[model samples]
Target: MPIFRPYDTPRDGAPVLAAGGVSRRRLPLNFSEEDLPLFEDALEAAIPQTRLLELEDVGVSPEGMLFKDWRILPESFSSPSIMEQFLDRRRSVLKFLAANYLLRRRRKFGRDCLWIVDDWSAGYFHWLADALSRLYVARDAAKDLVLLLPHRYRQLEFVQSSLKAFAVGSVEYAGAGEVYFCRKLFMPSHVAPSGNYNEEVVRGLREMLVGFYGREGAGSGAGERVYLSRGRAPKRKVSNEGELLDTLREFDFRVVHFEDHPFEEQVRIAAGARVLVSNHGAGLTNILFMNPGGRVLELRRRDERERNWFFNLASATGLEYFYQLCDPENPDEGPHTANLIVDPQLFRENIRLMLAG
Candidate 1:
């Protein structure tokens, strides 16, 4: 009943402290069942990198935007050519290096303006995978690229309606100097929920949500079973939610609540679901507007260990994920780990075996 292992020691002269996660645990020197596929291949998968690493000596000071292809925090890597990835999040990265050093000192946005300093800017799947990485890059690599964003993020109404499905722009602040990111690219950051999911960030968040709601038309007709009802968040409630919404309304589940609709109708009801069913929150990051052989399930809370970012965005958007941990009438009430308490006939037999398979 003891094993634990991790430090493969050689974090190339190791130094950078920490950012999080590393719950070392192990037990099975000679356990049975062929080591359960080496404990499910040492479960921790989230690898998704869609290449964007552009950096031509990025600098800009006054506290941030240094970038040598920023994305450092994997528990502060000790380096192995990962060259100590970095980020200075006291946030909005010093208001995007003081609005790119006052728009390159009043030369008014030289090199086609691309100053998008983000740190989950009010998350909705972390600003749809960090502000559209300049509208999915490769527009002749970076010609006349304009993705400013900083006008105090226009009071974040889903960041001003997701910046009208960009080709977007902003930045109305001034106060600092020494800017030179002549089109620096890194795109692909967020790491909170089992590593990080990438299929180019679920195909640039499903091509900016079908270029702002259009994949098979928006709204009305959206209902192939949804049930994402998280209700006024008192800590991810579902404590037998009226017997799990009467057993998910006997199967026609369309219980909705991506914050009471309107983020383009919550991507047209998660692209007219084909079975979503939620209990984890952030409205299951709209399952990246589902549709790619869909079916999510996900409901965990018993023993809650948080963040697997929508089960690794349901395996990078191929969505057929399923989970169900619930069990808490009061397992020590008050630590608030998504305070759930559902067991209504085992959460309706795991939602009737996930709607009968």
Candidate 2:
């Protein structure tokens, strides 16, 4: 008869041990009893009722967040010393095996999972590969691993490339999945536009707003977001400010030329506006925090160097969105290289649709 293990279907059963026929040698390392309980608590929350075989101290930082290495230890290796020594060993092989074992266990237990790792980005993916290769296993079980990227696409490509290099079989990217690998899957409670502000951060913001804007304006707060802008007049090559001014005026918005302010103040300003507008860039990411029905008027480059990520965000939150494409022709270059001018009619229509919606 086949061994009936909980790991066969990731969705069912407990996380199992994956030793690959080799017995594990535990390492000796000390962890404060208080810290151990806290870690155990987190593990329980992440994987309820799942058995954990503490193997080693995975990594540590000044912030006091301990990344422990764990595997589903078989009954024979249940002795704490197996985990103790695993912590002390610095050899790459031991570390690699420890991670693989734990990951294999997680895969066997949880069918679909969301990993909210603190900013591992693509670097975390590389570690997954290393752990698998050391054990001579190079297959990903049929599951989706979505990474929550702290930075934009350009910044994380290196890690993306590394994952591609290590992938043995076919694995496809899921644009939107039930789970995602990210520092955060949704806006923090403090940033959430709701009456019940349970999070300490959100409560703090509420208190600050009460002090700053009083109850009326503060009561209208949705989510806090930082806005960035070039403070000075746009140089000729930097942006077409004249065209932007004309187009913005057509939409009944008075262009406010200002320097970068503190993050809190920026959010405060955005909260007061019916529509927030900006060039295609990072500053626009703040729109993610806006309340549903709020509008984002983006000025996209005519060359299409930038693409809107609002598709996912809009789908997630019912926010009204519009963009005015700006084509900057290089007068010094040939006619073929010249950019198309902004279509004023398109700009007006987008604004009208947003209001109508």
Angstrom error at residue 341, model 1: 1.6
lDDT of 2 by residue, 1-357 (tens): 111111121223323322212111111012234333222321211111211122222221211112322222212122235434543454643454444443322211122322222222233222221221211121232123332222232244333432343323333232221111222111100111111111222223223332443222455543222222433533322243454455555556644433344434444555455566665544454444355566666655544421333322332334465555566555454322333355656655655665564
Task: State each model's CA lDDT, in order.
Answer: 0.52, 0.33
- Candidate 2 Cα deviation (angstroms), residue 225: 16
Global lDDT for candidate 2?
Answer: 0.33
Could you tell me every candidate's TM-score relative to the true structure?
A: 0.30, 0.37
Where is model 2 more than 4 Å wrong at Cα?
1-56, 60-238, 250-259, 302-306, 328-341
Model 1, CA-based lDDT: 0.52
